[model samples]
Target chain A: MSGGSGTRNTNTEPWGSFDDHLIQGSGAAVIDMENMDDTSGSSFEDMGEMHQRMKEEEEVTAEAAATDDDTHDDGEFLGMKGLKGQLGRQVADEVWQAGKRQASRAFNLYANIDILRPYFDVEPVQVRSRLIESLIPVRMINFPQKIAGELYGPLMLVFTLVAILLHGMKTSDTVIREGTLMGTAIGTCFGYWLGVSSFIYFLAYLVNAQITMLQMLSLLGYGLFGHCVVLLITYNIHFHFLFYVLWLLIGGLSTLRMVAALLSRTVGQTPRLLLCGTLSLLHMLFLLYLHFNYHKIVEGLLDSLDGPHMAPMQRVARDVAELTLNASVRSLGVTLRAQ
Target chain B: PDWFHWTRTSFTEASRPFAGLSDVSISEDIPVEGDISVPVGSSRRDEEFSTLDEPVKETILRDLRAVGNKFIHVLYPKRSSALLRDWDLWGPLLLCVTLALLLQGGAADNDDQGGPQFAEVFVIVWFGSIIITLNSKLLGGTISFFQSLCVLGYCIMPLTVAMIVCRLVLLGSSGTVSFAVRLIVVTASFGWSTFASTAFLADSQPPNRKALVVYPVFLFYFVIGWMVLTFSPSQ
Candidate 1:
């Protein structure tokens, strides 16, 4: 409670960023001490008193910064300054070093104290409640902002490509091939998007705002790396659905981690418990839908792919087909020749 | 009469334990040093009781009274109840099932069709679920499985409406106009899905600062994933 009010004022200042409060509070505390001593006595008498008081205050401040207790370093101070003129420069250097060390220690102490002070004044229970309330806005704002910046950007690109591919397929006269390619592209895009998005959202839900955008991106990279691993596994196993499910599981696990962190930070257990229950219900439905509809969708796609269409070489279709086929064949031939 | 009966009954219940005690014999429990014996439940017995000594007795009685008060308070009826009174587990389950069914059904209907009708529907529902679920999970509220499914349903409703609008717009439009519209539609799907993917990852497992380097990597992979899925023979 020594500088409690001053600290509170600093903390409550409008738009008081972290550095602002630290610098302001420390400076104010020192200045308040200096002013109190200056106003206490007569000019000449006070001059001598002021000098001593200033020295005492400086020492106290330095000590407080170094350690809350002020007893240990008195001898070192006396030794450094006792024969002042004899080694004035040396003494000055020592003082300078002491100042640097003291300043750093003070900074460290201040940061620790500020973070811990909230716990002392507010019960852990109360702080937790506030933290949960605070989380709502933090989640809302952070979720959309991060997703818009990170997730949406890549999604846009993928959709564009898919659209182009679809357009190419639609124009193709080779009914079965066009249908098959189109179906595959559509299905794959659908599956990939579903898997990736689910995974990404899950990842987003797990992290805290203390995390920087860069860190989030990197974690996302890890998720994609996870995706790559899944893809490799899927390729080896030759099970598409498994791969999709695995991608989702990874996403879900990642999201669960974020959810856990958020829950840990949250004050009440009730809301989180409810939320989890709700998610479970939704998950079961999604699973059920996937189970029931997967075959029918696949069948529909196959039928569409096999439906009657123009001949194999409509002008636009011919151009794209030739280009893609040639490029792929060329790559294959090069690979074979290399082998 | 009601008040008297209730009070008498309560008092009787409270006093029953004390009434059951019979003999208090010091000599039977321990050999008496001299001839000092105390009678049980006598007026003089209060002074003989060690616990009845002024300071000690006061402390013991105070503690017992406090415990009895606490017990009585606990037995009192509660004042308020929870908001979710009629909530049932099956309701949420059914909603979730419905959403999943819609998604699967739409996908089936639209598959391999040159038209974007059902694909649009499936993507909308699927992506909507992803976004809503991610948000709900991150927010840490009592989001029931059914609530999430409902949210998924609600989120996709707009997309479904948009698809209908798109069809209407394309009816009288030129071929190039149609192409552009389709392009826009597909782009939106990809973009939204990609965003969902990244968001899902970001929200799920938060990486350290160094993980920002992975943004491009994720993007690259996302594109690759999209390509593979789109072009794979199985699809």
Candidate 2:
């Protein structure tokens, strides 16, 4: 207790007359040192009281100095003295200010949509040509130096697939909501895109291949467009057997395109082939997953279309084919139904 | 040095009033073998709460009881700190794995591969919680990192239950009725999770910034609930 008083007395000697006037004007609370000594030997009360006195003194001086010639000095005094109150409060204030600044800085990045336009900008002709280019097994002629990927195309492809799938499913008498179908489609589509792109990016990095994430994203995105086209055709046909055949044919073609893109950037022979094979396998697995889960064969394909140019035997054959197809699809659905 | 001494003195001052009372009670009634009536955050270690020569089974049982108590606290959430005071990750890990496994099973039932869906659910739950915890910490919440995580994870119990109920509903039949039933269950559980987590966490956050801390919690549970609601065993 005596030591606490001694330190306070020593620390206060450095203050000038202005500080003394400020302390005196605040209250006699600062001058009442005897009351503190009678409390306890613990220095906690002493320090808390000292901080309380300093805070009052600064507040009083701040008002007086604001009207006088020491405004700038009092501002600095307030800033420095306010910090000595509570550690947790001070830390919270500092963190809140820093976070506010960081949030604003981050929000500014999206303020200008033009900055994001680079990822979305493409002509209709460009999209058509790119979709056609993706359909080809390989692009040997006029291959660009770097593959330019766009998120807009991939996102549109996903949206289109979700739209067509919902339409086809609804036409087939399946009662599902748009949001549910859209969520599943977007989750599976982008999940595969992001997962496979990161996988390929990691493999490329391992082999020291010079490729950017955008290239992998664009490659996979375009590959997905091929699958999306297959879905569209199958939707039109609504034939289970035809859908399978198209899935295999177009799935293989898209895999080839992805391999060609990867092989062009890589150097080594064995690693290139291994990477290509693994990637193609993964791509096929994703396609198969979609085939089983997402490929809903809308019924009445034969009923909806009329082949006017067919002979009598051909028409009879078409009727028989539709009968068998509808029967088999029904049996499969019944067997797969939950018990 | 002054701050350290000040904190210690304040702590001692706060406990002084209760010291004599506790001492008198201790002399009157000694706690039994399984008595866990020791007040939390006391100066003594957990081992000293009971006898030192306790059997292994008793210790395990005590720990299990503590975990169960936390689950009950989450189920019936009030403005209590029991969840925060005895925080553990075991319950959260269990809930996360169970939910992920149930989701994976749902996919597998459709003759689809189960690995990706399991990993997807696992990553979403864990990654989402970590992001929420980081946000809370960055917002100057007074809670400890693991404490917030524990609350978030334990609150997932309701959603995990909802997922189980959803899977069972999917088993009965899938149509608009089943979908409606699953939707109601998921929505109710999602609300329960959000309320329970915020109840445990609200006190630790700054008064003005409670909404900031809660918005992320709301989003985190909403995403999980969306996954649960949209999950179809057939698909």
Candidate 3:
């Protein structure tokens, strides 16, 4: 503590201001911890809890002294000053920024659809190599990674909306009242993604998963891109039954696998599976719900694009589907009567 | 460096013109047939079922067993240690062919395209694998381009199972039962492929960039898996 004061007194670099701020911050935190009584949502208590957790993991506590490991930069900020007791969060912040940029590059490459992978790799960096191309729809799975924020999320959001608009325009007679489809598409896409990511975050927290909300948010955001494509395919195509099944399996596995991997060390298997199962089921339901009410929701928003644009044969196929559904329902009703 | 040398040699060998285009016996006694065509990108180390120079009948037998092991890995993906013991491309090439046929059959009733178009499937697989291989190379993946392709090809085993299930489900049932079966198959296979592919392709990348490569690799298989799973008769 005396050393901290001496270092503060001798401060000379640009980081000195942040150092002073951190000193004040830590000082206030220590005071708060000592003075506060039991209070709901008490951050002081939370800090103690986090600190206790950190201490429980010996490697993490040891890592506190070693700034070499980058993964530990996230999760918890000990509020402890630098090893010298003088270095503030500026150093940590710089490390964090570097990590974020590296993350952004990877995320950007995977998220950006227009980014072409060259025939041969000239760049020495691996991140640069991840850009190799194929016309396969498989790359579509990586579309959701765009949710890593910055321009990633917004860019895909626009792409998804445009896809919706294109499909809607091609299929619908008059409902393409320019901005309405765009508005609804944006609303639904954002609403579903934000909701799902937050929901996963909440579930992860409940399971005591060693994850941050932003991290969970980003994971879900990336995963949601695949879900949107499934929806778009369902909307544009004559039948989405196969696509629905595909989404459920792939979507569930992807989400669960990703979430499980992220918090693998923090959360146990049973609870982890439970959380993933729930999230997967909820997403499946969301896709099904999206499919069931697709027309009702989008077509309900009446505009110049609302008239019938489906071909006569397409209408026949729709009727056939309705007929099968009716027949199945009737068969169930008959079985009930017999019982 | 030897790895690159092998890669360069294979590319040169692949581009070389063979003398006779006739279906000649591949026995060692017939040395002229040794210069026959091979799958593009397949290296000397990539001798799937049989190398041209190796004893043909014996190599074929060995390859059959290797394929069995690889296929068995599909059923028991957790036995990765044993499964990946002998990696080969024939299994994956065969897998792509089977998948293409399955897709064609699924989309058969819909007058969009008829029969299994081998070229399209080949082009698509080649293109996708090249992209993934390039990424793996850049990410410092130890697996060779053909090796990664082969592994990825074998990883599609689950998807093949899923596709078969999808076709069967679509044929015999509808609604909840169909959805339930498909859900189980797809989830299981997707998890399998994702786990299997990632396990096969894991590298010494920094944790962050590992995800950068791993996630895309995951998606690459996932997208391919989805195509295989969802390609069924139009409802």
Chain A TM-scores of all predicted models:
0.25, 0.53, 0.42
- What are the per-model DockQ values? 0.01, 0.02, 0.01
- All candidates' TM-scores? 0.23, 0.38, 0.37
Per-residue lDDT of candidate 2, residues A1-339 (tens digit):
221221332122222222332333443213223232221222443456566545544554554554454435445566676644444544665576557545544543222333444665555557667777777766652343356777555655554554445444433334323334445655667778888889989988888766788888888888887677776565445566777787778888888887887777777888787778888999887766554445332112222332544222111121123422332155554555533
lDDT of 3 by residue, A76-138 (tens): 454654444324454765687567545444544332321322221223243232221100123
Better of 2 and 3 by DockQ: 2
DockQ of 1: 0.01
Q: Give the per-residue lDDT digits (tens) of candidate 1, residues A48-88.
A: 43444455456667755655232245445666656554356
Superposition error at A171 for model 2 (Å): 16
Best by lDDT: 2
TM-score for candidate 1, residues paired by index: 0.23
Most TM-score-accurate candidate: 2
lDDT of 2 by residue, B100-167 (tens): 88876553232334556677677667766876776565555546556777889999999999999999
lDDT at A196, model 3: 69
TM-score of 2: 0.38
Give residue A298's lDDT in candidate 1 (0 to 100). Answer: 44
Worst 10 residues of 1 chain A by lDDT: A32-41
Alpha-carbon RMSD to native, per candidate: 29.1, 21.9, 24.6
Q: Itemize residue pairs with steric clashes in candidate 3.
A: A144-A222, A174-A304, A174-A305, A174-A306, A174-A307, A175-A305, A175-A306, A176-A305
**Candidates sorted by TM-score, descending order?**
2, 3, 1
